[model samples]
Target: MTTQTYTPNEEKRVYAGTTMLMIGSCIGASLLALGNRFSNLGWPLSTVYMTLAVIFSFWGYRQIIDACTYTRYSTIRSLLIVTWNKVIAEIVGYATMFLIFGFLVAYCVISSDYIHSIYNFFSKTPACNQPAAYDEGLCNEYIKCVAASNKVDKIIRAIVGGGAFMLLSFVSSVGILSLISSLSLILVVFSISVILGRCIEALIKGKLAHDSGGWTRREPPIPYKPDVWSVLIDFPSYFSLYTLIPTIPSLYAEMKGSISEKTKIIHRTSIYATVVLITIYMLLAYVTSATFYGSNQENYRQDNILNNFSDNDKLVLSVRILYVLVIFTAFVCCLFPCRAILLDIVKADRTTKRGKVLFFVTGIIIVLLLTILAIFVPSITLVFDIITSLFGFVLYLGLPILVGLKIPVLKARREYMEATRAAMHRKDPDTEMKQTNAMEAKIRDRTNSITAFLSVFGPGATERVRQASESIVRRMSMTSDRLSIGGRADRASSSSGRRLSSYRHSHIPFKGVPSTIPEASDLSKIETPPLNNVSLESEHARQQSRLQTIPETYEHDRNRVQEVTEPDTEEEETTHNISTRVVTEQVAIDHSHTISDEVLLEGFTPPKVSLKRQIILWTITSLFIITNSTSFVMTIIKIFSPKGNTGVCPK
Candidate 1:
């Protein structure tokens, strides 16, 4: 048997790849779906939502950084270990992984639909011309019948749709999706070119119309209809809303960079790249919307504005290419995170080979299921909303905040104690203890400063401080025994224990020692004793014995201290102080640099402004959600409602 150690090539160019992955991952079927979503919010609200998305991007970046720095565990597993109890962490991790898999399944269905749409569009000419193979009258009648009654064809469509999704899933399992993704990128570039060309033409025409007195300002399109605003607002909202899933993988990769500085650079670059991509997307969307709305067509019927233009314009071949490219990229980018979460859940029990195999098998199953569902329930909007709103909220917003709260509790406890001591000593008037008091105050101050820094930056900053302090202790231990005792105790207490039982239980081979503490005997032995041959008095004594000692046990006391003070060496203290000052001074030098270097490195950045951005973003996103969901719900309601529209358009 041979052991293989995998090391990432340090010299690889990550910026371009990362940027593309981020863009591709973020923009998905949602871009087209959002056109309809934003239509409900109207143009003004939609613009506000787009701006809010930019703000949320920064906020999301900050939260990721906070989680990374505070958790000090590069892997999601490690962070979970520290933030959650072992059992909870495992459960949450598995749940998150399952959610990601669900998302991947949904993506596969969408990808198939996109491909199918393109295929049907191109094949139309031949199909229409071949009257022998294709009965135009029969097809027209079939479509009209479907349009007249949605119920008759729905069951059959569902089965076909599910089968198509399953096929894509099977293809993905066989690694065919990767090839598709690579080819899709080229198409994506072409599509962007087409969109840009159309946008330029529209803008030019609009300006020309204004100058020639051919343009008249008409009332805003469908002022009261929420669907109009939903389309406009949600379209741009895709920049942030869609980016969350893809960012997970990119952030994971960024953390794997060889140098910390490289990681920081990658993080910063991702933020700027995202902003730039969103700006381009927004511009394209605005132009498309404006052009379609400016025309005399019924506003609601102007679905897929970009595609509508591409169909008539020969020059928009490039734009169609870009759309395909985007679809491919989004699919690929999403796979990384989806696979990562899957690996996280299964890696403990399975080998890498087995894991990969399992991933493929599972993905295939999901693809099939989703495809069938899509076929029968061909509502992309409904599927996108359910997946995005439910899982996106959990992964992006809820999880990070929960993790952040856990890591800081210990440091916060230390700060509170030190503050209490400082207050107590301030009132003490004993002159003989002044020097001792001064030293205590100094220690408290240092701890306070470090804790404050950790609170703001996250656990990673604290770990760095601790490491620097340890190095200093190692160097100084040669000359001073006083420092050595403290350093050894710190290492013994901090290194051998502190993590929850579930985390330490699997790793440590020893059996007799407690799961949390190597020194203490197994707690289970004392907690649950043998039942045979025990007198009532003896049993009572034993029960009382267990009850009396449990609270005073070494493990319990150690845990208490662990919860208060993080172990630090004298050398580490000095190093921490110096590094803290350096980082602070660097921040003072340049704000953006601080943002890029420190904040972005963690995969999050704070909002440039205050809660205002969050408020606005949340409001618009909520509105978009409401309008889209309402429309979907209404469609369903209409289906069940008496004498309401239930007919589906002919295929």
Candidate 2:
């Protein structure tokens, strides 16, 4: 029997590819809905809030990238696993799941309108009787000739949107999606440019200002007092505006080149995405506010910016087409992170036929649920608020900040370990000990400060504060003994690998054991050939000096050296591939390993669930339950909870 040799899947995504992936995925469709939501804060104040979010969001994104590099964690859950525990990781997973579900619900409702408009734009159905009489805006010129659109329009649109969703589901292949996403971004930018130009033209022609009093340019920007509670709720508004921050882990994973190169990619991604998003957000907000101002204008309020425009007007309809184009592509791109993470959790790899089935089914199920939501409870801003303010806080703001605080201690410990290991492996230990002490002392002082800061839970400790503190304390303290750094190239290559950069040792098995591999799909477990060639001299050289910058793993067992030559087989893979595989796999590990299933299955400890984690898990789970409960209750109450403005129903 001949065992078939298959080529491994390795995608070489460039920097531009990174930018396109982020822009397409992060730019949310709900952005078009943000105008009316923030009308209270006025355009200037709202712009300030959004622009600041963009800047802070950029800082947050970079910090997340740094946290990953410093810790060498490829996936978000891996970082969570290493830094905290499985419980914390699981909590984050739950958050992602809930957020995605909520987004689907919200997207279904929002996308329905775009779908309806798109259908109305092209077809002359009974709903749109006067196909040729469209120059009239929704304000009446064109609407009089058209039949009144109702829930039927939304249902029909949902069906069509579902078709588009299904089509993108299958074609959302890794490489192909990159090109698709880039194309989508182009469409969005072009479309936004047209609308932006219209906004500017209206403002210049004094068409937007209905009266001299409506133009408040010479007057101070609208007076606004933002409360803490209101601000948190309003984050969903911004969340809908900027959805890219949630996908940072996947972005980090796809980055090409060295660690620095990847960081540069993230840096550029943040700048480019932020600048573009903030610019458009400001302009859109300005148009919405300037177009509809004061308490009287609130009476004519619509759910989104499109509702403010005449659906029958040729110019507005053209812009609506652009929005539909963006929403179609953006919605597909948004599913990637959610789908990828869910697949990993379920132990389904997308590399196989069965895995592809699992992938497609997952997408279909998600869209199906969203379609139901659109038909039943058509929510928009409230859903966005809940999604962003709650889970968004955890994934976007909390983890990054926690990681930022934790990085210094981790860096210190790493430095200390490297210094100590170098001294031990040096030709003249006596001479190196003198070199190590000074650096070690500095690191020790830093670690002491950090550990102290971590230990104290002084006051005003809410669930988030408690969760973050406990998580940081647990991960740092649990790894305190093993904080001995000098990762892959630094540790003694023990037979069991318990001490080999802690968990990273799982990448290598018994050093010189010869073996035949089935496949590289499970990178964590399987070892490569020529495992015994590492000499103590080479190991010591690496330990005492700076390691090579190549992507391959540089293993060094300073305490022991075993050299055994191997006879070549009929078909042998390249040394570079085998070696590179070792290091690369280390960078991209998950919960379990293929070869070490017995030990890997027992990898993470059971729920010694810390107070912070418990709180987080509880809050997230509760938040999910409570929000759905509240929404349902509110839906029932909307039959009596003051008719027109509750935004739940009968609008």
Candidate 3:
């Protein structure tokens, strides 16, 4: 039966949808809630923590790249099987999936809280400028009187909020969730713009000044002594914690590329992005703190510093609305991957009708459960931090290093035997047995060194492999001389015979071969018609004839050879020579019965981190400290020292 292929629509959706998913999923509810939490620390400590989180994130990304390179596996489940046992892999995969689902639940709850707060605000606002309406107790009694007269507004608000969440879940399940996320990103951008503009205005007008005299003269400055403990515990830490879960899928996808190259990109991008995000967060925190301080206002209770500036700033109000909308969209986008990953862990591939049904049912159940939990859970931020930190630390840092070490160790011995056999086959017949044995020993040592070096995660692996392969080619040059001195036709036939003989002697069964090795006559039983004699009536017919004449086993072996051979196409002779050497080397190692599974599954022991890695790590650590320090100094200068006073009051 022919395999079903993805249509253009499906393929387009997968790539575009996935990219949008990454961008939207990256931002969430933490952006809104984190400002006040960090404000308590002032600005200096907040900037420092943000800088450090980025550094650690980059390091974590590099570790993932390293693990994926040696293991050559993309999915967490697949990587786990190679590093640990199958049982452990399955368990870890499931646990990670569950953590993602929990994030979705938290986002839902936070969204509900925001909607509830907005509703409560409108419901408490006085309809007319009546004293009875303004009085707290009178207003409560009037609201009760109004609710008895008109309960529709209260009921509608509840329905609108609850309905919005259910609609978001439904759209997400059908895979249109990314479109919703894009809309959310737009909202977030607008909100950030409003907040940033207000900050810039405050900074430019010197409104951040501290007053030395009551409502009069200002102090020269006091160094900003931000609460370090509060910053770490409440602000920057929460942002890092929230971003951790969303960071996993993107890093995991990046593992499909070359590990060494991709690790650098991930590391650099993470560091740079963190620095930028921290700067923005700190500036906003400082402005809000300066405005609200000494006003008997609790930091967390303050929603927008814009409200304090003027109720007439319609532009700022509009921006605030956009910001809230953006946050809401981001919350919706974050739910998709959490659901997707959970489904993956459960082995729900969505390929069958039954599987699709299961996905919908599971999503509905999760939403319902989360909505119930939201009623009881006081702080979504605390729950998010505990769950994300636990899983993100384990999956990103611990798993990759463990897997990189395991696979290389199991595969080393087989490569050694192959190198030994090739060296023996090339030696002169007249050479002393002891001398030939010595030469073989030298080849084995070289091959082992090459294999060991390649197992590490770096550019060095590629260079070492090229050097070892070239060394083998040089040895083959010497063997070619002895073969040419004999009759040309005789040498060619003898070379082929030697290759087959080596294969037989090495005792490694060919990949497709059964457990037992077949005799020479059995090898002869496998035949193909001459390529030149194949008939062709049309292009399709010619293609079919060519395909039919090729043995499935031969095609499979050729594909394997092509993987190594295609890169060196500048020299046809060299290509053939290398292919022959590689084939002979395999035979010498008794790999005749070797299958594709054996090569792919073959493990190698990763080399210990050398001095070079230590130096790089140290360099990164130093840079992180310097960058953080610079940002902190700038923030302090902006906050405590005032240039001139504007009409805006400093709390």
Backbone clash numbers for all candidates listed: 50, 3, 21
Model 3 CA deviation exceeding 4 Å by range: 1-25, 85-102, 109-161, 172-176, 183-186, 200-236, 239-264, 293-295, 298-300, 303-333, 337-353, 376-597, 600-651
Tens digits of per-residue lDDT for model 1 on 267-346?
A: 66568667766776666565555544432322122244343442224455335545545544444455455555665655
Question: What is the Å distance of residue 500 in model 3 from its true position?
Answer: 35
Compared with the true structure, the alpha-carbon lDDT of candidate 3 equals 0.47
The numbered model that scores best in TM-score is 2
Q: Report model 1's TM-score to 2 decimal places.
A: 0.50
Worst 10 residues of 2 by lDDT: 452-461
What tens digits encode model 3's per-residue C-alpha lDDT throughout 607-645? Answer: 454566556655654553444344344444543565562
Measured by TM-score, how close is model 3 to the native structure?
A: 0.51
RMSD of each: 20.9, 22.3, 18.0
- Predictions in order: lDDT: 0.46, 0.54, 0.47
Q: Which is the winner by lDDT between candidate 1 and candidate 2?
A: 2
